[model samples]
Structures are given as structure tokens and as C-alpha cells.
Target: MAKSVENQVEQTKVLPQYVAALVANLLVASVGCAMSWTSPTLLKMDSGETDIPASSDEKSWIGSLTPLGAVFSPFLAGYTADRWGRKTTLIATACPVIVGWVLIACAEPARSIPLIYVGRIIHGLCLGVAFTVIPMYCGEIAEDKVRGALGSFLQIFVSLGSLSQYAVGPYVSYLVLTIFSATVPFLFAVTMWFIPESPYQHVMAGEEQKALEALQWLRGTSVEAVKEELAIIKENVREKMENKSTPRDLISTKASVTALYLSMGLLGLQIFTGIDAILFYCQDIFAASGGDLDSSVSTIIVGMVMLLASACTPFIVESLGRRILLLISAAGMAVSLALIGTFFHLLNNNSDTSSIGWLPVVSLVIYMIVFSIGFGPVPWAVMGELFAPNVKSMASSIATSFCWFLAFLVTNFFPTISKELGSDYAFWIFGIFAVVAFVSVFFLLPETKGKSLQEIQAILGG
Candidate 1:
């Protein structure tokens, strides 16, 4: 018994697929850095620290540009992943991501607003591609038992990236931070080059031998040990690829349409939770609340809580299932947002709010904890799990692009809403939407724990 336990530990020490998942997500982390860069740096830009004259309106545009750019990359990413395979397409994204960061880095020296805007647009474009491909690649490579855990890694790395920026960006010079962020994707590309392609993609292209080899490596087993699994993968791919699916096919059948609606619905709920607005403007939110801790320090605390919660979600989802977690998350978020809105209302009224100055920080921390565990990650995982393989790439691209499009709207308008309509109303609107999200998840979402892809298809068919 001791010998068996020791061997299990030894096997885990060299998990090549886990290695592949982590390295690929390093690029996702870079996207997270791009997504939240404005959190710490936007204030400095408005102060003329970067020598780029960005007024409040320009700052809004700057914060919104990444999501805007992300909305466009899905079409190209879906095409590239289908054509060149997932590994190659992921590696190719690094160049534009690096270039985007470099443009922002150069903006400080040239004092050019256009350079920064161009750089943010480039970042958004790559953000869309990463969101489209990473979940599919991770889902394709993971074992059935470990799939939820592995799928959650995408969100974990994103939290890691956001935490890295939240912790470091406030303390470092803007140029230095952008330069450091640029290196993450380059490292992702170099490390990703050494990993094997997804066996599913290999099978789709009729490269059975290559698929066998790749599966063997990913499974940490001998060729014969993986052959049965390889055959299953081959059959599944063969079934999915019997004919290509068209755009109209996405809405043609009940099952396909159901999957699409559920996927898009979760994303919609997630967006209306005002997650992007909160993330992009986190520090500013704390600053406005007159918190006890320094705004930067409070922001770091929020980041830490978010990262820890995200890291815990893999295990939690495995044990509890996805739909329940979403239910819990939406309910918790509603209460937290209402608390924050109340605090802001008191502040806006010039009422004595010093006693509850802690409310915003506490409320945001709760909000982060809940959001990290469920809506932040589950929707992306479920999106990959829902579609038939032939339409998986295309459906994911549409859902991902739409997710970012909603993010663009929220982030771009959040500050304007806070300024023009009072921050209290902004928080209240998000709180109300959280209530709506709770209702939607309870009525519509399905449990996906421990199910095979074929089983999931059947469930959606019902």
C-alpha cells in the first residue's frame, strides 16, 4: 500500500499535460494584465505621469479598448485554430501581445496618446483570441476526471496575472510594468513550442500516429496504455466531423440552440454583474469610498482574495458541481453589491459614513470571492463543453467575442455613469442585475459534473 502511494506521488511529479496547461495559461495571464492595466496606471496617466494627455474621456476609451479589440479576434482565432491546430495558433498570438505591450512601453518615451491607444487596441485583439482558444485547448487535452480542475486553471492563471499587476503595478513605474507584462507571452510562446498538440486536433486531421504519441505524452503512460483512449478520441472526432456546421446550423436544432442560449446567457449574467467595471476601476472605487486602508493596499487585498478563491474553485466545482456554485455566487454577489450601493448612497448624501467606511472593501472582497469561484470561470469551461466538436470552435468564438463586447460596454460607460448619475446608482444597477443573474441560473443552468462530452450533448438535446 505504501509502495502504491509512493508511485502515485512520483507520477504526479512529471505531469506533462499539466505543464502544457500552465504554460498556455501564462499567455492568458498576460491578457489579464492587459485587462486590468488601467486599474493602477490610469490615474497616473491622468496626472500627466506618462506625458500623454488623457482626459477622463480618453481614460474611458483607454480602459475600453482592450475589450473592443478582443471582440474582433474570435473570427480569426477560430479559423486559425481549425486550420493550423491549437498549439500553433496559441504560439502565434504571442507576437501581437508582445507588440501591444511594447507600443505602450514606447508611448512613455514619445509622449504619444495614439501609441497607447494603438497598443490597447492590439491588446484587446489578442485578448479575444486567447479567450477563444485556451479553453478549447485545455478541454481537449484534459482527462475526463481531471477536466474540471484543469479547466479552472485558465481562470486561476488569469487571477494570478491580475494579482501580479494589482500587487506590482501600483508600486512600479508604468513603463517598467508594461515591459514586464510584455515578457510573459514571449515566455509562453517559447515554452508552448515544446508541448505536444491536442490529440483531438491531431485525430481531426487524420494523424492517428501523431495523436497516439501526443495522448501518450499527455497521459504520462506507455503507448499501449493509451491506445484504447486514443480509439475513443478518434471515434468522437469522426462523429463530430462527418460534416461541417454552418452559421445557420447554430440555430437550426433545439440542442444546438439550447447550448448557445445557455452559453450566451451565463456570459450575459457574468457581464451584468459589472465584473469588468469593478476590475478596471477597483483602485478608484476604493479611493472614492474613503477607506481605512490605502486604496492601493485595499486593491491588493481584493486581488489576493480573488486569486485564492479562484485557485480553490477547481476543487470546489469538482465536489459541488457547476450550477450550484453559480447559484451561490449570484446570490452572494447581490447582497454584497447592495451593501456597497448603500454605503455609496450614504456617502453621496453627505451622511456620516465613517462608521461604515469599511463596507466597500468588505463588500468588494465578498463580491470577488463569489465571482472568482463561479461565474468568472464556469461559463468559459461550460462553453467549451457544450458544443459539438464541429461547431465548438465557431460557437466559442461567437460567445467569447460577445462576452468581450459586453465588457467593453460596461467598462467604457462605468466611470461616466458613476460621475453623471452618482456612484450609488451604478452599484444599485449592478446589484439589481445580480438578482436577475440568480434567477436565470436557478431556472436555466444544467449540472455538468462528471459527464462525458457525449453525455453532455445528450443532456443539451433534452
Candidate 2:
């Protein structure tokens, strides 16, 4: 009996799921590169080092357009994912992003800022699809035991993509970087062509045979290895689809409405953590830091810190439990943001911050570390976990789209606020948001660490 049990455990293959998750996230990483592209390239534009001309206002619009484009597309994305399949949605979305990058690559030769705007908007539109479907696919395909770890790959890959841009953008020409960015979605498309659709998605489409095969493929094991799991998936899909999930259904029930609120609030606070402003304007923020480190080097260092933090999260998130990690992460970010605000405040007043030139980097490093572990990835994971499976798809689209809309507001106005009001005021405002997030985590957030999706929904259902 003991030998049989050990053999059963050894035969359970998880590597294939991990590989699929990683491949699916390649497009997400490209989104990151597009996000941070403006960070380095904006610097060149600001200083007239590039042939393309953008006034500060136009630059802000360029920086903010992706999120704005994202704001309007998630509902459509959800519709497509539900009707077609997660795999198809991911594959189809790649086309627009590739076109977007190509437009940006060609913009330099034309010296047209309008071309860049159109490219960014197109990229953003597709990104809404990526954000909507990726989490659904990741959460459904994973076993509950490893869901958090796998789900975190969403943010981890985003950071990895952004890090690649930060590390490479400063050294390369605009055309070279844009060309490289366009290639990422193509690679994602190629790799995704070979992976199976989520078993849950297949079940939703009433294809039990395909669902079984997909689960078997994703688990990298025989039918026997995944039989029980496939049964559970089928049962859940049947229950959830008694009434088809639609946007109107999201707010029809009290429990689902609460879940939607939780989703929006959780993800909304993540954006208010000032991550968009920090990432989009990383080079400028560092330049404003008055630090001894070169601005380009400083941006790279921050990107590295963010990437490492995001990578380490999946390893520890399960152990720490969701609420505790969030509490710690929120408090840490609040303090870090306050310290950064103080540094800026002092520097603005001519208080000679030469003695503490390192403060900004240290604070932001700490911010990235704590933010990555909890507020950064937990919201998306928990968002998927807490909703009733019936409303999950629509709920995800609303929450994700709302998050990007808030991101647009922040990214669009950050430059004006920093230059006109003061950078210190901006950081202080972000710090206050962090404080609210900490309180919310302590009082309202549930610890979702070891729970299955059904279990999580039960908690929210009450």
C-alpha cells in the first residue's frame, strides 16, 4: 500500500502545466515591454534627442493612451473568450499588438507622433483581451493547491517583460526596440498554437471529450491521472452555466455584486499604489531623485528589483497566507511612499538632500518588494477566486477594465501634477492610498491561501 501511494504521487506530472502557463504569459510580458517603452523613450523625446517631436502634453497622452484603450475593450474581450475559447482569444489578440508595434517601429521614419498614438491605442485594445482571459485561463487550468503560484505568473511575466525593456531600451535605438517589442507577441502566438485550451473552457462549450483530453495534456499525464479532476471541472461548469454568464448577471445577485465590489476595490487600490506612475515615468522619477546613480542605471536597478520581487512571490505567497502577506505588503508600501515623498519634499525646499541621495532608490526598492508579494498579484488571483463561477467571466472583465481606467487617470496626469503641484504631493497622495489599502486588507480581505475556487466562492457567497 505504501509503495502504491508513493508511486501514484511520483506519477502526477505538473511540469507541463507550468510550461503552458509560462508560454501563455509571453504576450503578457510583451504588454510589460510596451508599458515601460515610454519610460526610456520619453526621456529621449523630452530632451529632443529623437527625431519625433512631442510636447509635454502630447507625451502625456502617448503615455496614457494604452490604458485608455484598455478601458473600453475588456467587455468585448470577455464576450469573445466565452464564445470562442481562451486559447483562441489569446491567439487572436496577438494580431493587433503586433500591428501596434509595427506602427511604432515605422513612426520614426515618418516622424509622426499621430502614428505612435494609433499604435499605442491599438496595443491597449488588445491588452484588455490579455488581461481578461489570461487570469481566467490560468486559474481554471491550475489545481487549487498550486493556483496562487501559477496565477502569480501573470504579474511575474509582466515584470519580466518590463525589465527586459528597461534593461534594453536605454542602450538601443527607438526603431530597434520597437521591432523587438513586436516580436514578443509573435513568439507568444507561435508558442500558444501548440498548447491545449483550458479544460474548463472546453467544458463550458459542452465538449467533454475535448475537455478530458485538454486536462490530460495540461497535466502531462494519462486519462487516469486526471479523471477525478476532470469530473470536478465538468460538474462545476454545468452548475455555473445553468444561466449563461453575462454582464447583466454580474450585478443581479447580492453575493456576486459583493464579489464585484471586492474585485474593483482590490485591483483599484493596486493601481493607486502608484505603480503606473512609477513604471511609466521611472527614468524621470530617478532624474528627479537627485541621486548619484545615473537615471538610466537607476531605472534598470528598479526594474531588476521589481522582477526579483515578483519572481520570489509565488514561492512565498502560499506559505504566508493572503491576508498576512497583504497586510505586510500594504504597510511596507505606505511607509516607503511616505519616505519618498519626504525626500522629494525636502529636495524641493532646497534642504540639501545630498546626504541622503540614496533614500529614493531604497524606498522604491522596498515598495516593489512588498507590492510584488501581495498587492501586485494577490488582487488578480483573489478576484478570480472569490467570484461565483457563473459570474466569473463578466466580473473579471469589469474589474480589469476598471483597474486600467484608473491607471489611465494616474498615468495621464502624473507628469502635470509632479511638475505643477510638486512631486512630493504626488507621492503623499499615493501614500494615503496605500494606507487605505492596508486598512482594507486588515479589516475586509479574506485569507484565501489553501482554498479551492468553490471554497473561496462559498466564503464570498455568504
Off by over 4 Å in 1: 1-14, 384-390, 446-462
- The ten-residue window of minimal lDDT in model 2 covers 1-10
- lDDT by residue (111-148, candidate 1, tens digit) is 78788899999999888888878878988898766666
Name model 2 segments beyond 4 Å from true: 1-10, 206-209, 224-228, 246-249, 446-462
Residue 41 error for model 2, in Å?
0.5
TM for every model, in the order presented, reads 0.92, 0.92
* Residue 443's lDDT in candidate 1: 82
Count steric clashes of candidate 2.
0
Task: Evaluate all candidate structures by whole-model CA lDDT and list the values in order.
Answer: 0.86, 0.86
| TM-score of candidate 2 to 2 decimals | 0.92
